[model samples]
Target: MSGRKLRQLKEAMATILDDLNRGDLFSIVVFSEKVEVWDPALGEAEMQDNLGRLRDWTESTTDAERSGTPAPSVITAITLENTNKAKRFVQNLTTYSATNIHGALMKALQILEVGRSASPEQTNHAEERPEPMIIFLTDGQANVGVSDTFRIVSSVTAANAGNSSIFSLALGNGADFPFLKKLSLRNSGFARKIYEASDTALQLTDFYRQVASPLLANVTFRYQPDQVEPQSVTRLAFRRFFSGSELVVAGRLHGNNVTGEVQAHSSSGSARYPFDPVILPTTPTANTMERLWAYLTIQQLLEDDDASTSPGKQRALELALTYSFVTPLTSLVVVRPDNETRPVEPEEASFAAADRSRAPSHVSPVSLSSFPVQGAAKTSHNAYSRILPGGYQDMRPISSSGAYYADLILPAYPVSTSASLDDILWLSPNDTTVSLPTGVNGTSEVLNLATADETNAAYAACVTPGGQPGHCRHLKYCVLLTFLNNQTEFLPFFCRIDSFVGVCCQDDS
Candidate 1:
C-alpha cells in the first residue's frame, strides 16, 4: 500500500465505533493515494502462534493484486447480514496505504451485493432488513484507476435508486466536487468538504444521527391533488425515527387542512404498514423547514466539497444540527420566566450589571445576563438567597447567623385544593376532609384537609420533615406522599401550601 493517511483514518474509525454503539451501522472507506478497508477479514487461527498470519497478510500482499479489481478483496468478506462479524474483523485489522475512494465504494457495493445471497430468511411475520448504508471519505480525486469517476458514480447512483443510502465526507484539501456530487445524488447520499481532519468524527456522528435507524425503510414521499405539492414544502422530511428489527419511517402532516398517511413495507414479510394520514393547515416555509432540509442538503454538500475550515464547517454544523430533529440537542429547552409558572420576571438590568462587574480591568464591561457560579460569592449581598423555583428544601433557621423566623408565604396552588396533610400521611390534620379549603380571604386556624384517591396519593404531614430523625415547619404544615400504581418506596413528591409565617415590623407610629 502507498500514500496511507493513518491519522485521518483512525479518526474516522473512532467515529464509526461511536455511531454504531448507538445502533447506527455504516461502512467506511477512505481514499488518498490508494484504498483499503479499515477493517480486514481474518481466517480462524489454529493456534496462538498464528500471529505470523496477520503479518504475512499485511506485508506480503502485492499492490497489483490488492488494487487489481475495482472491488477490493474486502467485498467478499463483509455483508449486511454478517455486519457484526465484519465489525469484529475490522477491529483487529490495521490501516493500509492509499485513499482510493471510488475503489473503496466499488469494494463496498460488492460487499453489499453479497447481502442478497446471505440476507436473513424472512418469515410470514413482519419482515425487516438491516438498513443499507455507506459512508465514504477522501482527500483526493480519482487518479489510480482506469475507470472514469463519472461512470463509477452513475452506476452507483443507479444501483442506489432502488435501495441503500450513501453519505460522503471529504477532508482537508484536494477534494474533487464534480465526482463527489454525482456519487452522492446517485445513491441519495451526501458529500461534504471538511477543512480539517479533526472535524471528521463530529461530522460522521452528525451524519449517522440523521440517517440512522430510519423510521421508514425503502421509504419515499408522494403528493396528492388538491393537497400542496411536495416541492412547495422546502424541508419536508422525518423529524424522528423509532427502530426495531423491522422497517423505520417518520412523517409530519403537511398544511393544516392537508391530510395524508405514512406507509411502510417490511422487506422480509412484504407487509404494508401504515401510519395515520398526517394533516396540517399551516403552510411550511423554507426557514421553518430548514432543519429537516439541512440533513439531506448537508449530506449532498459533504459529498461534494472539502470545506473544512473551522468557521466554514461550523456553518455546515449549525445547519446539520438544526435539521437533526431526532437528536437530544434539538429536544431540550429551558423555560423562561414568562413561559413558566415562576412569579418573578428575570431582570434585564441585573444581567447587564453582572456583566459589567466581571469585565477585565482595562476593558469596558460587556453586558451579560448572569455571573458565573464559583465556590465563593461573587456579590457581597444576599447571594445565598438564590433559590430554585418550584423546588423545596429542608430549611432551618440559624441562630449563630442571627436568622429569625419570619412569615414565609407560600401562595395557594393546585396542591392545596387536592392534598391534605393526612392524605399524604404527612402531619396528621384534624382528620376531617374539607368540602372547600379556605381561600386567601377566608382566614381560619384550622387548615382544610383533602383526600387522595386512586390516581392521587394520600398526603399527611409527618411531624418529622426529614422522614428520618425529623424536622419541623412552624406554620400549619403537613407531609404529602403520592402512590403511583400503588407502588410506594417513598418517591419524592411536591406539596403546595398557602399559609406562611413571617416577622413583621412593630409599628413605632
Candidate 2:
C-alpha cells in the first residue's frame, strides 16, 4: 500500500471507532508480503492519580522528550478518538516479502480464533457466536506464491462461512472486480471498486461505519401462499458493521395482517426482538403513506439517459411521478386479478402527475390514543440473579508479559500461515483507583488485561461492590467495565490493527 492509501485507511477507520458501541470488535488485516493485526480502539479513560503506577518504569526509562524524539514520523497522529484501546490490544505487526491474499484471509481467521480462545471470560460473556468479519482491501490480483485462483477462491469462501463476513474492496483500476465480487459474494459479503484513489477513503469509511455498524444478523423471512411472497414485497439487503446495527426491512405489502419480525442478539444473552403485524386499513392518512418515491428516485439515478433515450427515461419518470403523487402505502393486496397475464402497474400508477411533483416530505403522524400498545411483562421476579453472577472468582497464573513476534498459524493450511504481533499485557482495575499494566501508559500501548482482569472486576463490582448487590449492565453475562482514570467506563470499541498505535509500531497494513 502507498503511504497515501495507508493514511486514507487510517482516517476511514477512525470515523468508525467513535460511533461504535463499547463491546464490538473490528480487526483490519493488511496483507502485502506480511500480515498485521489491528485491534479494537478504546473509549475515553477515567481520571486517576497523577503519579500513575507506570510512573515507576518511566523513572528509569529516559523520556523520549528529553532523549530527543526518534523522528518526525515516529509519533503517528493520534487523531482518532477510541484508537487508544486498539493500539494497546494489537502490537508488533509482521512484515513479509510477498502480497499473498489467500495467506492474509487465513491469518485473519486465526486471529479471530485466538481471540475466541484467549478468554474464558469472553466466551462466557458472549451469548452467541461472535459475529466476526474480515474487510479485505487489496489493489491487485493474486500474482505471487500459490496462484491457483479457483482453489484459492473456494478455500477462502469455505473458511469465511459462519465465522465472518468477508468484504473485499478493490482499490484503483488494477483491481479485478469480477474476481473480488466472486470471493465476497461467495462468503456472504460484497465487493466494491474505487474509481480512483481519491474516492477510496470516504467509501472505505462509509463501508466500515454505516454498512458494518448495523448488523442485520440472522435475517430470515417467512411467508405463505405462493401468490403472496415477502421477498417480492420489498428487496432486502443486509450489511454488518462492528456488532450492533439495526436491520432495516422495507418492502411492498401485498396482503392484510402483514407481519414482519426482526430480532438481534446482544453481547448479553438477552435478545432484542421486534415483531410487526398490522392490518391493511383502507382509510389512508398522511402518516400512513409509504415513501416509495425514494426507491423510484434511486431507480432514476441508476438509468442512463440521452437525447435518443428520452422516451424510455420519460416513461420511468412518469411512473415515479405517479407513485409520488398518490403516496401509496406499501399495502398491495390483490385476491384475484381480472386478467392473469396483465403486467401489473406499480401501486403508484393510481396518482396524478401534478400532485406527485407538489408532494411534501413524507412524514407520518401516529396517534397512540387510538392504537393499542403492549409492554413486555417481567417473567422473573429477581433482578440480581437475572443480571450478575452470584459468586466471586480470582484469576490464576497471575503474571504474564513478553514481546515476541512470530507467524500466526492457521490450523487448516500451513502454507497459508503468516506472522502477526500478539502482546499480552496485564492490568488491575479495582474500585475507586484503577491501575494500568506496570510499564503500559497512554492509549497507544495498552496493558493486556487478561480474562482474569475481566472476571475479577465482575466479582468486585457486581457480587461484592459495597451495599448494592446488583449487576453492571443487567443481561446474564460477566461484564468487564474498565473504568478509566477519569471514572468513565470504556466499553469494547473496534478498529483496524494496522492503524494500531504502540511501542513496536510496524507497518502492518
Candidate 3:
C-alpha cells in the first residue's frame, strides 16, 4: 500500500463514518503482525487487558506480544463522538508488519457477535441475529499467522455465527484480486478492485454505498426439483439482497418452462414470491445454448483471469493448496479432491492427442475447472485459454532440392476460434527457423515422439510477436524445399508455415 493510497483510504473511512447512523454498530480493526481493535467506549488499559485475554484464547503468544493484542469485541453503537474518535485513530495510524489476514478477519467477525466455532457446522435459526455485514479493505498478500488463503477463508466462515456478508475491496494493482474476490463470494458477498488513482477514496465510499442498504436477508432461489438439473443451478442461496441490486438466476429447464420461487426475510416479516412456468425464447441452436451454459459455467472457474491473455506468455500452471478451489495462485499443497487427467494417454513415449477434427465434446482436461468449497473465496477474470495443436514442426533442411510452390490446401481443422483465415499470403522463403514453439504460445509441448496426428489433434491459428499470422506446416508439405537428403522422411522437415496453418502451408505441387 502506498502512502497516497493510505491517505485516501483514511479519507474514505471518514466519509463512511459520516454516513453511518445510530442504528448501525461498527468496529475498527487493523492488522499487520498483530491486530488492534479500536473501541472508543473502553479505556486504553482496559482495552489492552481485554485484547490480551482474547489473544491468549485464540493463538499461542508470549507476554511481549500481549501489548499487540486487540481489545475484545465491544457492542459499540455508532455516534458522532465515536466516529470522530475512530477517524482520529485512522488518521494517526502508521505502522507496518506482516499481513495477518486470517487474524484480522477473525477479530472482525468476533466484533459482529457471530457464533464462533473451530470447524464448520450446521447453523440453525441463523436469522435470530442482527443483519451483519463487513466492508473489508486490504492490500498485499497474506504473510503472517494463517497466511494460507483457503484456510483463512474457511476458518472465518466456520466462525461466522450470523453469516455476515463480506464485501472486500482489493485496493491498488497487484492486490491479489482473486483472493479477495473468492473470500467475498464464499460469504454471500462480492469483491471489487479499487484502482490506485486520484479518486480511489471515492471508489471506496461508493462501494460501501452499494451494500449499505439491505433489502432482504437469507434469500433463497428455488425451482421445481424435476424441472431443472439440481447440479446445474448456480448461486441459489445468497446472503443478502440490497435495495439497489437485483438477483440473478440461471438454469436449464427440463421442458420449455419451469416453476420457481424466491424466499427471503425483509424488515416487516418473511416474504415469498412465486415464478411459475417461466418461458424464455430460444431462437438459437441447441449447440449455441449449450455453449452459453458452458461459457457461464466456465466463467466461474476462470473468473477474472488475465495472466494467460498476453500473446507473449509461453506457459501457465495452476497448483492446488489447502483445497482445490477455483482460484488463481496457491502457496501450500493440499489433498486434491478431484483429478483431471487428459483423455489421451502416453504410450511408448508417444500419445494420440486430440486434433482439429471435431468440435470439443468436452473441455480439455488441462483446463482448470472450478469446484467451489464452502467458505472459499470467489475468483474474478475467466481465463481465456486455447488448445495449441501439439507442438511446432521440426522443419529444418537436411538437403536442398528445387521444389516449386503451388496452390495451398488448408487441412481439416476444428473451429476457427477467434478468427477465420483471410488474406492468406505465402510465407517468405527467406523465413528460416528461429526458436521452438515457433509462434507466440498456448502450450509448451514438443512433437518429438508423435507425428502430426491429424485424426486427434487440436488446431488453431498461431501468430508471431511480429504480427505475422500463420500455421505450422511440414517443410516437405511446404513446396519442394531441397534438403541434404530425403530429409522429408525425418522429423526435421516440419516448420510452421505462413498463411493457413495445418498439414500444409503451401502444397508442393
Best by lDDT: 3
Stretches off by above 4 angstroms in model 1 are 1-5, 18-99, 119-127, 146-148, 158-162, 197-199, 222-224, 228-256, 266-509
State candidate 3's TM-score: 0.51
Per-residue accuracy of model 2 over 265-379 as CA lDDT, tens digit each: 4445334444444332444432222333233333333232323346645554444343332222221212233422222245321111111111122221111101111111111
TM-score of each: 0.40, 0.41, 0.51
Clash totals in order: 67, 28, 30
Note the Cα lDDT for every prediction shown. Answer: 0.35, 0.36, 0.48
Order candidates by TM-score, high to low.
Answer: 3, 2, 1
What lDDT tens digits, residue by residue, belong to model 1 across residues 212-266? 5555543433334454434323223322222411111112223333333343444
Segments of candidate 2 deviating more than 4 angstroms: 13-21, 26-28, 36-98, 118-130, 161-163, 195-199, 224-227, 230-255, 268-509
lDDT of 2 at 40: 32
| Candidate 1 CA-lDDT value | 0.35
What value of lDDT does candidate 3 attain over all alpha carbons?
0.48
Top TM-score prediction, candidate number: 3
What order do candidates take by lDDT, descending? Answer: 3, 2, 1
